[model samples]
Target: MTLKSVFVLTTLSLAAGCHGHDHGKSEGGKEGDHGHPHGAAAAELPGQSVTIWAQRTELFMEYSPLIVGQETGFAAHLTELPSFKAVTAGMASVTLKYVDGTTIVATADAPSNPGIFRPKLLPQKVGACELLVDVKSPQVTETFSAGPCQVFASADAARKALGEEAEAPGRITYLKEQQWKTDFSLAVAEQRDLQNGVRASGEIRPVAGKEARMTAPVAGRVELASPAPLLGTFVKQGTVLASIAPRPSAASDSATLAADVAARQAEAAAARAELGRAERLVAAQAAPSKLVDEARARLQVAEAHLDGASGRLAQYNANSSGGAAGRRFQLRSPVAGTLVAIHAVTGENIEEGALLFEVIGLERVWLVAQVFEPDLPRVQGARAAWFTIEGYEQPFVVDEKTSKLVTIGHVINPRTRTAPVIFELDNKEGRLRIGNFTKVSIATGAPKSALAIPEAALVEDAGKAVAFVMVEGEAFERRPLRLGVRSNGWVEVLEGVERGERVVTKGAYEIRLASASGAVPAHGHVH
Candidate 1:
């Protein structure tokens, strides 16, 4: 016999065996038929009906009725694979096969409930019967079959038999092929030397000696130099910032000083002429040698007085000719930095030693933290720190290579009970602004190894810390975590996750939403 014929004969034999038992009389006709009296005679035949359950392509299928000329029902439950939640949106169909090599197809309809589909089937000749359920959703299409279920005399018997073989819940089977279609990425939990740190409030400041206040050198009217310096203007050392012209006053006026210098010059000229005359007379025996020597001494004294007056006037660029142009002194910057403040404006009369400009170098900065007295020892012993400036999203790091601990205040504030702890950081980028409030964490204690993951990898699920761990290429399991110290961008994982296991990092929140909603459309790809 052919293989097809042999399979048919075997199915027929099994069906016969199923109906062999007498339903009318148990053994001695002691009881009337309690099970499906309408099909009592058929139930006596060996294999009148059967029920079976099968899961195919993520849809669950249950089939009943193995005998010919018997009505059968096929129910299909559409669900997402791995997550087994009911998929309410889909189309399903059922195909029925008979022993006579004939087939019938019917569309499945949803009952009052969603995700549950029912297709009707009535066999004409029932040596054996088989069913195939096809389900299609927007994301995928799948086919499932429970080939040739044995038909029982009653529906109750079939339900009872199928219940024993039902699948377990909470197990999902996400495929690797589908994972690539969504925004999914993973990171491995690693053993790292994480620092336990203390958090403190602080502010960014210009380092001491790195800032300077330019003051008026003398009492004068301020005249801004060309290309006037404004607030935030960067200047170099010795760059002329402004000019201070001496104000004409009774005490010391430029015109009066000029007259005095002229008078002194005239006196020096007269003395030199007198000395020359005296020397010539002595040579001709017209005067005594002592008289010539005395004239020479007097000329020297006058010349000395003239030099003193000229040198004094030169400091103000003063012109003895009494020109206002030579009466001003140029004020230059003493340091290279940005002008943070301007105390005196152009044409303003400033007094001697008055504040004019404040220049501050920003290539380096100070983070001054107000450390509580209890934590002062930790702040002093900390090897490094991470600080966040106001208005910036990222934290700036300060380590031995780029920073140093400059001081710890000896006096604590009486009101706040806190002392200043200072750290210097390189600010070459100028991202840190002076006087801005900061949040600081100083790493303290000895270095110790601990399992940690990126802070981004953590998410909250029902108020518990959760992370997603990749069990397979595409399958992920939600893990509750016990977190320890958090330092820098990493958080120590005290429990729930293991070292070397890949966890979702960049898209952890996305996964959490998917797991919560039981529906995840295509997400962005992780590069």
Candidate 2:
């Protein structure tokens, strides 16, 4: 054979050998690769691993568009999840499955805030649904399910209903506000106080003419012959309280009696002689008319003297026996009332003008209260007033006529710097006292209805007031609010918030913190 032919045949045998070896290896690799692309196609397909940061088992969740409010930062997280393999940006949907076998679907769309997935309402029912995710995978044939989402409308509400496990990460739950309608108190606007007023402490006091005192008119010993039964007793008109027997004036009585007896005896002797002379003069016809007249006049004078003597004797006898002498007069209550104080003792001598008894009529009582200078203007025009006593929390009506502003003191109290404003109140029940402190609220003006919210829902930072409103499920956005008057625990929301919007009331502090950390996303609402 020639040299060129020998070389060509050797090369041909080597080429065949190389080809056979390549064929065997390629066939073996093909079998081992399964259905996956051998080159770029397998690498080009998306890759993702199932990751559940945390699981909150059996959390009672509500699934509704209302749950996906504007405040929740849920949109950003949903959009970011699409970056993971097998998940597309707009293809994802979240559903809540309640323990009671109810379901609600939530869809993701382009959020106004970049990269945030604005949620579209799939339904309005608040229940539960399984969240299934379908993504293209090279190694797997079936789609992946995200297990169960513990969705809730609010963190605290969910925690209260489903316990602490509901707060687990990535365990979104919906809080149902079933109690929102019922668990609220209404501030109905009627004729109630509007502006702020100062509260001042004060007490009721007794006015003059309402209080009375009884005293002895003359010095005398107290007698037990009072018509009233007891010492601290009540006496009406004409009821004798007590009487004192007089001590005898013996010398004056004896002088008056002697003068009366002597005068009476002389008058009797003169009258007998005059009658005898007058009868003889008339029978004999010897006396003149003038003499007869004179005799008759003398007899008339004697009889007049005797009558005077008899009256004087009778007066003297009564005085001598200590019956007509200075004696204790019965003391009676000048007014009909309750016996409050009794100073006179049984069988004790009392000086004239001394205090004997004190009585008070409980038919009406004054309700005095202090008014601060600042609040005085508002109260001055109050048509009605109300007050509550310590023991009685029930407020009673105070009419303007019965409780007018009697006086406003010129001097303010040194400690309180408040003027003592007295209003006469009619406490016919006698429940009030001279020094019982009372809580008074005056109906100074008419009431008007205004948009209002609980003060707790507000977040005060610097001078601005803000509130976190629930947007989407478990997400909240901070919103500025214009505030007006505040009464009790409620504040009137003048602007930036409307009625019926679900707002973050309890967890505002935490929401603010989340917002500051950028953990909360500002997402616009679709519903």
Scored by Cα lDDT, where does model 1 land?
0.63
What is candidate 1's lDDT per residue for 229-328, written digit by digit as tens? Answer: 8888789977787887766663345556567789999998998899899889999998899978898898898889888777766754532223565566
Candidate with top lDDT is 1
Q: What is the lDDT of residue 525 in candidate 2?
A: 19
Best candidate (score: TM-score):
1
Provide backbone clash counts, one per model: 24, 31
Off by over 4 Å in 1: 1-187, 215-222, 227-234, 245-326, 341-356, 390-395, 460-462, 469-477, 504-510, 520-527
- lDDT values, one for every candidate: 0.63, 0.46
lDDT of 2 by residue, 1-527 (tens): 00110000000111111111110111113312111222332222221112221111111111211232312112212211112111123333444456676765554443222222323333333445454432221222122344444343543333344432112233211121211212211121122223332355666766646566766644556664434446444555445555543323332244545676787778777876876787788778877667667777877887778777777565445322233444235555566656777676677876656787776655566666677767766676455556666776245556676666566577767776666666677766677766677776555555556777665577787779987765333434566898776543456777867664546555566556655664323211110
- CA displacement after TM-score superposition, residue 46 of candidate 1 (Å): 35
Those runs of model 2 whose alpha carbons end farther than 4 Å from true positions after fitting are 1-196, 223-323, 372-378, 409-419, 439-445, 448-527
Q: List the candidates' TM-scores in order.
A: 0.48, 0.35
